[model samples]
Target: MSTTVWIILAGALVTYLTRIGGDLVLSRFERIHPRVEAALNAVPAAVLTTLVAPVATTGGVAEAASLVVAGVMYLRGGGLMTGFVAGAVVLVALRNLVG
Candidate 1:
């Protein structure tokens, strides 16, 4: 196999292993509490925030504005896709204006 093929296989194996590990751990607990469920649901957004925060902080005005718009839209109960679109539009407009 080529290097790319080998890398892809390794990544797939790692992903599968992680999923199995999580399932194994969760299998011990038949039912998680409502609060735990809520926290679990928030994990994706929390991770996304962590990923974006550093870039937004270090980036120019447009990046910061985009982050603010995305966050506001999300907090206002907009769907994830809507929040992404709103942030992207703001970022594009700001970049065109300032860049």
Candidate 2:
């Protein structure tokens, strides 16, 4: 009814169409190439880096320390939840101590 609602619906429709289109095209192939699969697998990490890089760069010491702890946990084979919990703990502790 509203312009904002129309815009949101259009965006959702476009997103759905693109996703379905990609699935349809990929489904025709018997097997995906290793390189293509690797690239697809890397997409999440690339997107995450894009999302976090700016915050990490501009954030304070507490944020930096938390991110470092989270990264260490990940490198040590911790699960995503573990890394997030560890980072949250570090961030809260540091903010309390620093502020």
Candidate 3:
């Protein structure tokens, strides 16, 4: 097999193992501890910040405004999906306005 094929197979195997390992670990616990629960809850927000912070700082007003709307929606008790929709709608509207 070529190097590219080997790399692809290795990547797939690693990804599969990661998913399985997470499931196995969580399943073994009858009830997660409060601290663990808190850590788990923080993961999504941390990931979101890392993913969005760069583009949000560098992008145009539409991007910045969309992030603000999404953040506010989330803080106001909207679901993640709702926040995503709010951000996307704002971004699209602003893009059209700017264009």
The numbered model that scores best in lDDT is 2
Q: Clash number for every model?
A: 0, 0, 0
Which whole-number lDDT from 0 to 100 does residue 20 have in model 3? 99
Q: Which candidate is the best by TM-score?
A: 2
Where model 1 places Cα greater than 4 Å from the true spot, the runs are 30-42
Ranking by TM-score: 2, 1, 3
Model 3: how far residue 24 lies from native, Å: 8.3
What range of 10 consecutive residues in model 3 has the weakest lDDT sum? Answer: 47-56
Q: 1 or 3, which is superior by TM-score?
A: 1
The residue-level lDDT of candidate 3 at 55 comes to 84
Task: Name the runs in model 2 displaced over 4 angstroms.
Answer: none
For each candidate, give its TM-score against the true structure. Answer: 0.70, 0.74, 0.62
lDDT of 1 at 11: 100
What lDDT would candidate 3 get against the real structure? 0.92
- Provide the lDDT at 95 for model 3: 88
lDDT of 3 by residue, 1-99 (tens): 999999999999999999799778998999999999999999888988798789888989899999999999989999999999999999999989985
Residues 5-36, candidate 2: write the lDDT tens digits.
99999999999998899788988999999999
Model 1 residue pairs with clashes: none
Q: Relative to the true structure, how large is the alpha-carbon lDDT of every model? A: 0.91, 0.94, 0.92
What is the per-residue lDDT of model 1 for residues 1-99, given as tens digits with 9 covering 90 to 100? 899999999999999998799668877998998998898899898988798778777989999899899989988999999999999999999999999
